[model samples]
Target: MMKNYHNSSLSLPRRYAITAVQAAAFFYFLHCSFLPFPAMQFPFPAMQCDLELSQNVIEAYIQIEEDKIEPMQTESPQYMSTWTWAYMQSFQEPSWHRALYKHLLEKLGKCSVLFFPIISKEEFHFTLLTFHKNERKWRHYNPLRSLGHRKEERCIDMARNFVNIVEGWLEYIRPQAQVFIETKKKPTLVKQKEGLPTLVQKDLTPTEELTLNWIMQNPLQFPFEDDMECAQQSVSSLDYGMFVMFYMDKIAQ
Candidate 1:
């Protein structure tokens, strides 16, 4: 019995040619049915000017140059997630953090002063994040409150200002880097305990140990200068996820 012609496969080139022809036919029909006014049908009007003057006719032609400015790109909230995670993992290296700080300041200097890093419970790493103020003043603007998902919103704004955040980190690392490097040469001691974050004490030098002790000894302070202090204090009264608020407010202040 002979195979059906329609069911038989054609050569690759022939198949592509037939597909091209069918696609062209489909488009042509679609154009004819929907777009009655094709470019050919709507011809340009002849450029004719009625000026009875000598050869001194001042002709001015407007030529539009290509736009040099690039269109702004829309990005998802987690666009910097991977890069930020990597950067955070490299926090032990002071040089890496310093380089990133310089780069972020130079590149994101134009970003709003209100823009700051925040780490959600789900997104546990810090990233360059921005929250637009719909119509309120910068001091009154809070993104978490603006987006009405109070239950899902479990984020702590790391700093009131991004500049302050970067500057603070750089300052903290400057004096501690040499000590941290020296301590890192020793064998690391890790102790895992239930209901507690992993404690790594072997990684700290004598100086770092003393510095850490001093930091832990210091009490939390609420400076009068911080604009967000009042708002933060209002929210800090809440029993849950307030640790970050307390810690960041104390350090950043």
Candidate 2:
């Protein structure tokens, strides 16, 4: 006797369970492929600044980049990833403007703080609009001015400082990066097979060379000179601030 074709002896509960599992699997694939779940409110939990630093602070606004070598994953063992920090300057001097600068410098004098020249964004913006013949519309807004706050006129340092400091103390103690100067090194030649053919030595800008001189003086040694090549690449590519603070709790420790 052949088996009962469509009427198997499987229990009713087993049949229902199979159907339910199939439905769940179908919905899971559908959601994964097509549904546009609310654009993942980025970063899980948002970052919150220390209230003390946010209130009446001059905001040193340091843009730091640290190259991290990731552990073995897949076929590659090492990957380069960046870590950033923006150190805020404390409310120190009586004169808001002068204090603005003194605090910046004081932090640099502590450790691994170096100086470098940056582009003139204000001038570049003016030039860009002057020559922009395209039809793209540009909107410029000043949040502070819109709120009826007068713009303060002051002279700020063209060269900014980068400080490497400890973490978790921004709420209490003032931060610092204490820098030292040492002799500069010669350019390094790298042989390349692609792009501009021929081997070329990467030359340092005068500012970078000078900064290297200053950074080498620190007793707390860092692999800065070796990383200078990569650092230059980072500075050119990234939209970074003038003042930078490097937190060294993880990398340095």
For all predicted structures, in order, the TM-scores are 0.24, 0.17
What is the TM-score (0 to 1) of candidate 2?
Answer: 0.17
lDDT of 1 by residue, 1-253 (tens): 1112243121022343344344334443233233111121112222111110000010000001002212231121111111232344335544343334433322221222223333332322222233221221222112223223542233223334433454465456445545555565322324447653343444434433433333334322222122322222122222112222222222222
Question: Local distance difference test, per candidate?
Answer: 0.28, 0.21
Clashing pairs in 1: none
**Highest lDDT, which number?**
1
Error of 1 at 57 (Å): 56
Candidate 1 residues lying further than 4 Å off, grouped into runs, are 1-82, 93-95, 108-154, 157-164, 169-253
Error of 1 at 168 (Å): 1.6
Best candidate per TM-score, number? 1
